[model samples]
Target: MLEKYASFCYDQIGSYILDSLDYFEDIRPHLSKANIQVSLPEYVSAMVLSSMFVSITTLTVLGSILMIGSGIAGLIYGMILSLISGTLTLVGFYIYPSIIIKSRASKIRDTLPFATMYLSTLAGTGTSLPKLFKVLSEVDEYGEVAKEAERISRDIETFNMDTNEALKNAAERTPSEDFKNLMWGMNHTLTSGGSLRSFLRERSDTLMNDYRRRVEEFSETLSLLVEMYITVVIVGSIIFTSMSLVMTTFSPNMSTGFIVRLQVLSIFIGLPMISGMFIVLVGGLAPGGIR
Candidate 1:
């Protein structure tokens, strides 16, 4: 498979090209947040080398085939074409990791409210930091929250890090602002000898209230949308149909059969489109769920 081959290529030959790139420092932090298993330098190097190889090969073949009888201008055109294609590929390669990070962040954000509530509940029991994280990691219902907790546990146990250090590292690497803030709060509470239970309880309550407010706002918006849909799609569609029928009746050139059939087509296609737009709008604006 291409994936296996790409992995092999990165492992075997990618590091060799890393010294040539100057942006390794800037890219290192993103690699952590993106959950990419590869080193930043190696990834960039592999991408650069692969893109170069592809560009060179494309230029050679296309130039030879298309510019056989042409002069330097033809060769230059081929190079330009190949360079553009290769540059697009390289850009996509770099952007793919950021996309992954965004998706992960979205999932984390959605599940954060419930996870905080769970933490607040556990904190009230006077649980130790490691045990609290272990319980969180073990719970399968929390989705990304559980996965992130597992990573935190692994850092503490495998890396032999203290609780505060582990939390700080997690905060640094997590793509979710909500999760980062939670970890920072926990870290600060531990360091300040403050009450973790009260902090988590208050934070969880805030998230719950914010989530409820968003849902209430969405309900109000949905009511307005329903009225709009009736006015614009339903009644408007009926009025248009009536007008078309009237036109067909009055005009000798217009066909009733054609107008009715067109109305039928609009009913099927246009009605669904109007409904789908509302669905998309609600989905885009809905508060992320704690799932």
Candidate 2:
């Protein structure tokens, strides 16, 4: 019996060690990969989980304590509230990561055109691909793209991975189709004796034209959006103000708190939202074109 127990313990320990090793290997590449710079914060993940549990537990405990004074009816209500709170907490944890990832993807998309333009310029100037990577790495002002390029350059120079492999690794890290396509074309050019400089220039031209068309579309849409908002705000304000005046005439003793609240809400909420919409519209229209 002792021998069987020892054998079982050894098997469990070995399995645990193997699983940990596999996890480490998977994360090891991701930590240093080129494309995506930020890792999901381990501390934040832990804190989020802990806080969620604490919140539910605290709410449950407080409700239970209060219910003890009210007997069976309060106990039932407290249990329902605890269940609702715990469910909501679980859903929040599930949704937050998805939202954050989507937001990050949008930011990455915004940066891609600029990175492509930078790369195209280097490619067009008769710089070899590896040298272009090195140049981008050295360029301090280019932000995340520069950092990503530098990682690729490092992988190539230190590990002797071919440009294609490094680029493939980068695409995997980023998980962006745009980056993947660019890397694919670049790798093909490097390996197949094709003219990379011309390919890059042509791609740059294509992307630039598409970007310009998008800007034009956004600009045209903005005028209509602005008109719509102005009409809504103006008409609503007029109607609401006239109704309030009529009400005041009818109910002279009534407190004007509702009107004041409406006015305050319109000024605080509508004005800021409208301004934000305008800024978004302008940003889309111009984009500063990647600079």
Candidate 1: tens digits of C-alpha lDDT, residues 1-291: 535545766776676865755655666777778877776656776677678778998899887776877878779888987998789878877787788788888777767888989998998998998888989999887877898898899988888899999999999999999899999999999999999999998999887787788778878987998899889998999799889978987997988789978988899998898889977877766656711
Write candidate 2's Cα lDDT for 20-51 as tens digits.
Answer: 34333444343333233333233123323444
Question: How far does residue 261 in candidate 2 sit from its true spot (Å)?
Answer: 5.0
Q: Which residue pairs collide, candidate 1?
A: none
Angstrom error at residue 150, model 2: 3.2
TM-score of 1: 0.77
What overall lDDT goes with each candidate model? 0.83, 0.64
Error of 2 at 235 (Å): 3.4
TM-score of each: 0.77, 0.67
